[model samples]
Every structure is written in structure tokens, then in C-alpha cells.
Target: MKNAIEISHLTKSYGKNRGVIDVTLNIKEGDIFGFLGPNGAGKSTTIRSILGFLKFDSGNIKVLGMDSVKDHVNILKNVGYMPSEAWFYNSMKVAEAIKYAADVRGLDCGEEAEKLCKRLKLDTNKRIKELSLGNRKKVSIVCAMQHKPKLFIFDEPTSGLDPLIQKKFFELINEYVSDGATCLLSTHVLSEVNKYCKNAAIMREGRLALLDSPDIDDDTFLKFYYDEEDL
Candidate 1:
């Protein structure tokens, strides 16, 4: 199968600190690829490189069969990205932010965005800075999904969301995949991976420690990591 994302010998560093080290991975088209790592394990760095938001010290990255750096603008047009941090103009209303994002993506925000806000129980009229963390997350999701891009890149997408909203997000993701859209999800939630991802890559200490199908049990997988450390 053709890959939606490909990284070959990718490396990045911050001064002397390693951000990523000789990393390589492939996420096939139409697959929901889970990226699991503890905080500061270079998952975000790698994602940024894939999106051409960050430049690597070495190696190559391809997204959707195009050079990551050279084709970023074109690729971004077909990709929906939800960053780890949700940012908005402090004075802008939630509805206004959603509308701006949808417009930038060349999408109509009239019906779909409104329906998503209603389903998430989000108050569209509230200013961004006035909303709670969970509500901010809802606004982000509503905006991200409004355009229905071909590939969705979610960085810690469910953070600050309530359980009910998280469940709804999962349903939305599955619905997208069922319609043949691809997804690359970066998260630490192993349970979510077990329930949703078909395959995953686990990053440890700036490198990929494991990459395989998600059918394996967490206990067994955890044991594998422990054994690797001679524990």
C-alpha cells in the first residue's frame, strides 16, 4: 500500500538536546495511525517536520506522496490539522473563530459547523478567552472538522475534553475513516488506541521503540518495553 506519510532517517536537535534521532516510519494511506509517546519524546517534533512546520537536521519526509518541505502549501490545502494548543483572537467569539477557520479552508461554515457546535453543546457566542478549557477544545474540533479535509492530523486532540465529548470525537473520527479519510493521531491514551487505531508507533527516548498493529493487549505491550530495559 502507498504511504500517506513517510520518514527516512529523520533527525532533529535543539542545540545539544536531541529532539528526534534517526527516526523512520511509514503510515499507509487510509489508515488511522496512532503515535504514542510520553511528553517531550519528540512526537510533536516529528509531526511538525511532517507538516513542514519544522526543519529537520537530516533525512527526508514525504506526505501524501509529495516532498514535505516543497509541497507543504499544497498538502496543507488537503489536510486538516488540530494543534496541541488551541489559539484564537481573545476577543473573537467562538462562532467567529470557527467561521474564520472554515473560510480559510475554503469551506462553507453555515450548516456543518453549526451542527457540530450544537452536538458538542458549545456556546458559539462566547468569546474565546471566556470559554472553559473543554469548551475551547470543542470549538477547535468543530473548526477542524468543518472542512472535511482528506487527511486529519490531530495532536493530543482530546485533551481537556469531557468523557462524553471525547466519545463523540471518537465517533466522528471513525465516521471520517469509514468515508475513506486518513488520520494521524498523536496521543498518549493507550486505551483510545486500542479502541480506535488500526496500527500505531510508540516513541521512547526520541526514537521509535515499537510499531505494529493495535490488536496487542496493553499489558503485553508494556511488558515488552520492560523486558527491553532488562527489567
Candidate 2:
């Protein structure tokens, strides 16, 4: 089977500043891969490169067997992405924003969207600008998962969610993976990775520092980050 994601000697730079350097990794199909790192470690940069959100200086990226840069449109067709920060049209209602997205994707997501809203305790009638940060995150989650895309990419997806809702979110992700989908989770929270991920990668200074099963304890993982800087 082909890998879900592959990167080789990937490098991205901003003039004198480095974004990521020679980063290489593989995420197999049907696997939930955890991307772990301290702040400013380049995790988000790497993700943006994979999503073709920015142009890289060198190297190659493939998602679901398609070139990330050359075939991004089709690649995104099978992907659901949740950014670290959730932003929506401030003037629209939660339901309206979600429905618009689902319609664009050509997915009949009304039933599933409603179920997810209930699970996350989101008020669909609320205006996007009126919702709290946590509620906005909930709306983003529903929009991302409602279409049941084959690949899920979440960047700190649980940031403002309460514990109860976080648990439900993980349950939903597990259910998605059980059906043979793939996931790439980038988070600062180690326990979330330990609870759901099968394999993990640690990034530092825009480079891959470690890649292994996340069986190690949280303290051990923290030890890998000697610097206290936030990425």
C-alpha cells in the first residue's frame, strides 16, 4: 500500500531565517501519526507545506499518493483540515457557515453536522463573531469532519475545548480511523497523542529530532525539549 504522506529532504526558508530543513518522514495509510514539538519548532510550517499553503524552497511532499504542490486541489478533495486557530465569517451563523462549506464540498452533511454540534454542545444559531473561542473551535471541528474525508489533519484541534468535549472529539476521530482513514495530529498536549496516536515525530528548529512510537511517558517527551521557547 502507498503511504498516506511522504516527505524527503524538505526545506523551507525565509531569507536568512530557516523554516524547516531537510525534513523527512512517512505516514502510512490507516495510521494516526502524531507530530510533536515545542513552540517555534516548525511543526506548523511543515503542515502548511504539506497542504501547499506556502511554497517551499526545496524537496517534495506527497499526500495520498499525489504531489502536494502539483496536485493540491485533488489532494484536498480527500482531506479535512483543522487549523490551530479557528476563524470564520464573522457575520454568518454557525449553521450557515458549516452548510456553505458542506455544500461547496458536495457532501450531504446535515445529519452528521447536527450530531456533531450536539456532541460538542455548539449553538448553531449563534453568530460566528458572538461565539467564544471554544465554541468557534467546535464549529471548525464540525465543518472539518462532517464530510468524512479520507484524511484528517488537525493542528492543535482541542485548544479551547473543555475536557468532556475533548473526549468526544477523540472518540469521533477514533471512529473515523476505525473505518480505515488516516490522521495527522499536531499538538503540544502529549497525553492526547499518547491516548490516540500509534506513531510520533518530534520536530525541533525546523528539523525532525525523533520519530518513534509514543509509548514513552509525558515527562520523557518533555525532556526532549530542553528549550522553553514556544513554537
Candidate 3:
């Protein structure tokens, strides 16, 4: 199968000694890939680089067979992204924000947007400033999934979500995957990795610490998880 994402010695620095270092990995098409890392471990840095939000110092990144930097606009056309923190025009209604996202992509969302909003229990008429943290996250989810893009990149997607909503969120993910989509879930939750991901990569201190399948025995995976933590 063709790779969905390819990072070759990807490096991004932030003066002094901060940022990702020599990261390389390949995520296959239609795979639910997990990116496990603690906060400040460069997971977001790598993701931002992939989305062309940050310029890397060296190395290369390819998404869906297109150069991340040179073809970022094209790549985005097929990718859905939910940031760890949701930020929208606080003065606008939730529906307006969702509409704006669809308008930018120039794709009619149709009933898909309404279906997601209903499942997530997000009130579209509510002003963005009135929603709670969880509700705001629900809005983000709808905006990200409404287009039903080929690839979905969710950074810490479950935070602020309740257990019930989280379950529904993953269900929606599975639903999308069955339609031949790919997902890259960036999170620190090991259980989520074990339950949802086929392959997983762990990051530490701005570098790749381990890359393995989560379907491995729990004992073996825990050993690797702790070993990396002790480093």
C-alpha cells in the first residue's frame, strides 16, 4: 500500500536546543496510526510541520505523495484536523464557524455536518462564546469531520471530552475508516492507543523513542512504555 505520510529525518529547531530531532516514520494509507508522547515531547511540533504551519530547519515531509511544504494547500484539501485547543471566532455562532470552514474548502458539507452536530449534541445556534470546553471541542470535531476528508489528524482529541462522547468520537473515527479514510491520532493515552491504533510511535525529548504495534502483548508493550519513561 502507498504511504499516507512519510517523514525523512525531519528536524525543526527553535533556537538554543528546543524542537524535534531527526524524526523519521511512515504511516500507511487507511491505517489508524497513533502518535504517543507526553506534553512538550515534540508531537505537536511534528504535526504542525506536517501541516506546513511551521517551517522545518532540514529534512523532508510528504503527505499523500505530495511535498508537505510545496503542496501544503493541496494536502490540506484532503485532510481534516482537530487541534488540541479549539479556537474559533468567539463572536460567531457555532453554525457560522462550521460554515466558514466548509466555505474555505469550497466543498458543500451537505447533511454530513448536521449529522455530526446531532451526534455530538452540539447546539449550532449557540454563540461560540457561550459554549463550555467540552461543547467547544464538539464544535471542533464537527468542523473537522464534516468534510469527510481522506486523512484526519487529531491532536489530543479526547481532552475535555467525557467518556460517552469520547466513545462516540472513536466510533465516528471507525465509521470514517470503513469508508477508506486514514487517521493519525496524537495523544499520550496508552489505553486509547491499544484500543484504537494498529501501529504506534512514541516520542521523547524531541526524538523518536519507540515505534511498535500496539497489538503486541500488554506485558511487552508496558515494558517498552516504562523503559522509555525511565529514559
The best candidate in terms of TM-score? 2
Candidates ranked by lDDT: 2, 3, 1
Q: Give the residue spans of candidate 3 off by over 4 A.
A: 215-231
lDDT of 1 by residue, 73-166 (tens): 8888878888888887899999899998878877786798888888889999899999887888888888778877778899999989999999
Better of 1 and 2 by TM-score: 2
Please, what is the whole-model Cα lDDT of each candidate in the order they appear? 0.85, 0.90, 0.90
For model 1, state the Cα shift of residue 136 in Å.
0.9
Pairs of residues clashing in candidate 1? none
In candidate 1, which residue ranges exceed 4 Å CA deviation? 220-231
The CA lDDT at 54 in model 1 is: 84
Candidate 3 per-residue C-alpha lDDT over 139-212 given as tens digits, one digit per residue, 9 for 90 to 100? 99998999999899999999999999999999999999889899999986788988999888888778885565
Q: Tell me model 1's lDDT, rounded to 2 decimals.
A: 0.85
Report residue 223 deviation for candidate 3 (angstroms).
Answer: 7.5
Candidate 2 structure lDDT: 0.90
TM-score for every candidate vs. truth?
Answer: 0.92, 0.95, 0.94
